[model samples]
Target: MEKVIKSSDRVKDHGEVFTPKRIVNLMLDQPEIQSKINDLQATFFEPSAGEGAFLVELLKRKLKVAKNKSVSAKLFNTKSLLALSTLYGIELLEDNVEMLVMNMITTFNIEYSNIIQEKFGGKVNQHVFDSAKVIIQANMVQGNTLEKITSDGSPIIFSEWKPVSGNKVQRTEYTFESIINQSGPTGTVQGATEEMDLFADTDFFADLQKKEPRMKKYALCGWTSIYKQEIV
Candidate 1:
């Protein structure tokens, strides 16, 4: 099953678009992220939560920690998972959002099932699954990060934090339009005023408040830098 899913043509074509699992694991394994997980106040956000790969892994790790610590069945209980809504994700594509929700539900089902079976000797509970499905559905949102608007005019807000370095986190907000235009068919015009103009808006600066409070706005064009020996 794993091989089939991993080898699917759609998976092969779109896999590169997803963050590599190894990289996700490494990032989550970082001491800073580990400490953040221990800090219940920390919220996780993935702006480009393609199919929710990172979210699933993070949940699994959290569940493992809860179990290992014997943190009471109530602490790791189904209700707790529902409240474990600290993780948030945004996907620009509606279809991808749907897929992400399904993936998250599946991940929850597997994790919950394991917990129930291990703790309660497989006394199945349909209510748990139903409740988890609802929670997962509610957590994933479909919207553009750049526009901060949904398919409808509703505002898009995510509670997740994109981890940066120690004691720092950034809210993941990519100006989808800006990214698309910058890399689009324009043929990479080194330093264009229009590109710079996009970064100068007050709205963009406001959005950066929680994520990149100190991030400096910069214009980008094609540039080459040579290192001492190896070209960079």
Candidate 2:
């Protein structure tokens, strides 16, 4: 049985209680979730992802379907990455976030390794593994979902990885606030905005509200090389 509560202190302090696997399956087995899991490009976000109990199971289901669709090892790598890109989560505790990331990467690697070995009698592709690491690190973040900010009080940001033509993907960054508010273009690449440039000339107050880059456009790259994210 999975330990639902880490400790009494954790339970009292943070109300840290993990959902059991049986309950997780019951929730996921619902028709709505079943339909989403069937679509490889469909995105899912967990507002309070504690060590990825739900995300991991979701990933396993997606990878299982991806394996069925893959004919070649190359295609498998891309499909697996695409599946990984669709899952996102936020955890308040830093330790939980760290574990979440590790669990995600480990689960991805195991699936990838098994598919490659059984299907192609080959080794895990380094580039694909590196790209998976990048995606997992970016998607699973340590932050308070209620406040939509990291522990440092900065707005949480998430990269939207959209698969473009063929094996290429386009990445766009959005503040969690922007995403939740639906205030601006969420799909397009972010460009200069006067709001982000406010107080630029005042060096004294520069540190008051740490600003993200005014412009963020990453060059279209193959899924395996997305980690580089060469600016366009």
Which candidate wins on lDDT? 2
TM-score of 1: 0.56
The alpha-carbon deviation from the true structure for residue 2 of candidate 2, after best TM-score superposition, in angstroms, is 1.9
Candidate 1: pairs in clash: 44-160, 44-161, 45-160, 45-161, 171-211
What is the C-alpha lDDT profile of model 1 across 100-170, one tens digit per residue? Answer: 89888787778767876786455545655664564465457787666655665344433222333432223
The best candidate in terms of TM-score = 2
After TM-score superposition, the amount by which residue 35's alpha carbon in candidate 2 deviates from its true location, in angstroms, is: 1.2
> How does candidate 1 score on lDDT?
0.54
Expressed as tens digits, the lDDT of each residue in 1-232 for candidate 2 is 6789889998899879999999999999999999999899999999999999999999999998788888888898899999999999999998889889999999999988998889867778999999999999989989899977678656678889999988899988888877877866453223324345455576634544454424377888999998786898
Candidate 2: clashing pairs of residues:
none
**How far in Å is the alpha carbon of 24 misplaced in model 1?**
1.0
